[model samples]
Target: MIAIRSSVAQLALLFLAAAGNGALFVIILRLRFVMEQHLKWLEQTYPAGHVSARGEQWYNRPFLVRSLFQFMLFLAAFLSLILLIATAWTHRGEVFGTMPQDPALTYYEEHAARLADGYETLSLETAHPALLKLIDEHFEGETLAILDVGAGTGRDASWFAAHGHRIVAVEPSEAMQTIGKHLHPSPDIEWRLDSLPELADTSASGETFDLIVLSAVWMHVKPDDRQQALETLVSLLKPGGRIYLTLRIGPSEPERGIYRVSEEALNTQLAELSLEAKKLDEQSDLLGRSNIHWVSIGICAATD
Candidate 1:
């Protein structure tokens, strides 16, 4: 998503620069033609060596100088166009992806405080009972390492930390991270600025976890990218480690970058990753929105 935004912004600037230069090139050429015509009139109408004719000659720059200036403008315009083409080509995948901007990121950035507050109002037990139950069944009596992707406001991370599990909380929104850190100051929870489809920093840290939580985050990923996203998640899991994911099953909210999610599609992705679903359950939306529901999935890798 960040790549998409950067590519789009670069393309827009290059386009504007190219257009501006092209417009200036046309304007200068027309102005030069008019000035040359006026100078010819001065030369024909005035006597040789007259002040008006001499002044016209001075105003009329040498042909080489005029051409050089025009050539520079043309070159600038041409180069801008070339650069625009090159950049667009280089980032074609990102620029032409399902979305130009991450609507979810935009919404979270704009409404971080409100959303964080609302999220905080819902207890983890109330919001993710199925996931918590699955976790208890799989990881009871163990203090496990956990990774919480899209750990907004650190609600779930804090919960895991409170239960004696160490957590790495990955959140892309700076505003949300700030509020989350302030709200949940547990030393067991390590906060990171990262996103899915590529958990760059988290992946680079060479850390594998016993559990990876993707609570209500997968829907924001484009369908084409979900496979890769699942791959990345699996890579971060230790052998036999589980992934507790909650799919938001509802209408597509294009404005918020939400997409349709289904258990079938998720199962396909899990199968491709050689993961087995340990728990699959559906629940009503915690907030009680009629059009929205949730699917909780717990998948585990083969033991080493």
Candidate 2:
């Protein structure tokens, strides 16, 4: 809304801003330094400039200009925040149960349901190369049975069958599973009418699996029951087997700027259970605007 620049940076930025006419600016050139110990070389390397920044770098700019602009931007943002707060206070009761439904996920689940309909054409489980590799390499003929925790349409189950593996898929939405089976045709994937937080009570799912997978479904869970949901998912995995999870683990308000999982805290939580974890893979898009952080399979065995 408004600009904030440091005093020294402010003066320089003003000049730059005038030149840019609100179109451009430049900042520091971050250098990544590495030490090659054996060769006894301390090598330093830096990119010439920021991705879009041009002209002199931030640290080299005038003090007052930088400060003024920095202060101005802050003030503008604060004013915007005030407006938002005022609006919220005026409409406090209206925010509850009125938060927008997540249309993106609805779209995703819908697609999954469609895939299930193409049961012969789409196998959700072994369809993804990454997931299938785990099945073939890690649990080959090892008594490992899989449970697709949020198995929307049973594509995963069908894939497991297509690959000669037995499987169970749990989908709470009846319409989705019905469409899924319609696509799959034959009774390949064992479908269950349950959801996360379902108990180990015999009256519940009534059984377990060698591996459990909860992929891209955590964020859809109601906030208060998420932990219980996690516990239930974990319980579904046999003590010596594993659980594969994929969730949004980044900045709390990533839409604003950036964030990542708390490394140490996530580790500590894993240490408390009968499981051990390793990050097996990672993928980034457009310089990590958003990333898919993969936590490798977590294995649990009985505590000695």
Candidate 3:
């Protein structure tokens, strides 16, 4: 089927993109090492009488090759980025620029909310127990209106719906959202098409929630912008509301080791951002690969 082919192609593209980035990164690292070696060689050769007279000169330098290689690396970087972006767009359904904003994210692909049969809540028996504990601590026995941001396929949202809580699931990725509708339907939940950043924007323009769930989403944010995002979330939550999110500590995520900012650090940052972390738990994931843990925070909108 065409759907199968598209899936395969998208996965292939992602693989190629990852390979290209790795290759490019290696090339850049090698070049930097070579440059450092070259500088050392020059310093020793020119100043220490290690080379013949005539200034041991520029004509003997291999700067042209370095320039050519640098140009090639830059070109490859540009092309690889283009390919990665293209592949992401091709595979990810209903994308809107950097963040997806298509209506497919709001409902099931078949356009019906009756297929939700597998939306059951598993106990402390998850591949990741921290998630369940966090959910229980925050949403347990509370009749609060909850918003599950980036609710992939409605697993968590569905669970909340099955319980007594009211939920509005929001997801931006069409593929995931479509699956979610099939998993968590009416008489249980209401799904929406949106992302956290966009939802916060909606909140700023006058939308709100008693509790917001952000699991495994913060790690995607670039290092420079995450703090501002935390502040924005603080602004959106209700007076007594809370945010339950995971913070993966350690060296696994080399790209944006941003969350390496420990829970204590997070607590301090939350304080500055006008949010109070009522309680936080240090727990790991299923794999226990990187020793990751989560910090659950609560907020009220004022400095005083």
The TM-score between candidate 2 and the true structure equals: 0.49
Over all chains combined, what TM-score does candidate 3 have? 0.52
Question: Cα miss at 18, model 2 (Å)?
Answer: 70
Better by lDDT, candidate 2 or 1: 1
lDDT of each: 0.86, 0.52, 0.59
1-304, model 2: which lDDT tens digit per residue? 0111122244444444444432222221111112123222322233343132233866645444445664564455455455555554533333333433233333444365454444445334323445556556668766557787767666566666676666777776556777767756445578776665553431265666777776545555655555566567666666566666554554444222222444354455556654466554443421244544433334354351
lDDT of 3 at 27: 83
Q: Going through the candidates in order, what is the number of backbone clashes in each?
A: 0, 28, 2
Top of the candidates by TM-score? 1
Compared with the true structure, the alpha-carbon lDDT of candidate 3 equals 0.59
As for model 3, its CA RMSD to the true structure in angstroms is 19.6
Ranking by TM-score: 1, 3, 2
Which lDDT tens digits does candidate 1 get at residues 82-184? 9999999866756886445577887887789998877998998888888777777778899999999999999999999999999999998878999999999
